[model samples]
Target: MTDNISAYKFDWPPITVEGYKKAENKVIMVFNLDVRTPAKVDHVIQYVVGRTVWCSLNSPVNVNILLSFDFRGQGIIVTKTQSLKSELLRLLNKANINNQVSIDFLI
Candidate 1:
């Protein structure tokens, strides 16, 4: 870390999804959960988390992903966007996420 590159030292996502949109790339999400059902959460995390990170790490360049999470700890509110295309949602058709826990994507 050097002071020569101040602007270069910035947060990923760049305050928006602009980079991903401009680069024409997709995003991957990684979350550490503290919910009621540990087994179910572990199943989803193991299956899908870090998938995009693995892809980007081995690629030429311009491949990127936003590493984000939703914390549903004690007395916390879950407000994941209704529009998010969750990996667990797509793959875990029979998981019954709604009933498994109180987690949800708010509209």
Candidate 2:
């Protein structure tokens, strides 16, 4: 005798709960600094991480820092709401070294 088994994948909460589903609206923002010196890279990373932490603490929305590293002078931030992303972008753009930094959004 032989037996067959099958499995299926299920997504909890389903798509119907769109308003309460924060994950569906998650946004990824990538930043690249033009600085080549190690000190400059460190400074940029520090400033970004600091601002991100501050925002996360003070804001009601959720903020997830995907990655923050000096490698190639790049950083990535993920936020649950678009407003939070805009706030961070504005803060970063207002910095003195804004000219040396490039920001882009993925999805």
Candidate 3:
């Protein structure tokens, strides 16, 4: 047993989400969205984050928020649950941005 331990090599732990997925038992859901304009991007992100926080606080299921936006009108939202995705879709509909917003998950 001592000889076997000596033959093994130790490695650094993973630091990113992808690393965590491989090293630990975890799953991350990613959703892709497109907003037609920079202003709309800002608005959509604000709405999503705000609602996610509010819902998480009031609801039993907490949403993990990880959002990335490009000035070029593309964005990606990373969440542990699909609730955030549903919220975003509802927001687009309520804001009358359905024509401008596109979800890759739905496409």
Best prediction by TM-score:
2
Candidate 1: residue 22 lDDT (0-100): 40
Q: Residue by residue across 1-107, what tens digits does model 1's lDDT show? A: 11122222223342322224345454444454553454645443443323332434434355445544455444334433222235444333233222111123312
| Candidate 2: residue 87 Cα off by (Å) | 24
Better of 1 and 2 by TM-score: 2
Residue-level lDDT of model 2, residues 22-50, one tens digit each, is 56333233444433454664455444545
Computed on alpha carbons, the lDDT of every model, listed in order, comes to 0.36, 0.35, 0.36
Measured with C-alpha atoms, the lDDT of residue 66 in candidate 1 is: 50
For all candidates, the clash counts are: 0, 0, 0
What residue runs in model 1 are displaced by over 4 Å at the alpha carbon?
1-20, 24-36, 58-62, 67-76, 79-107
lDDT of 3: 0.36
Q: Which pairs of residues collide in candidate 1?
A: none
TM-score order of candidates, top first: 2, 3, 1
Model 2 weakest 10-residue run by lDDT? 1-10
* Residue-by-residue lDDT tens digits, candidate 3, 1-107: 12122111223233122111333332232334455455555555554444333333332232233333332333433441244446555653544331322232432
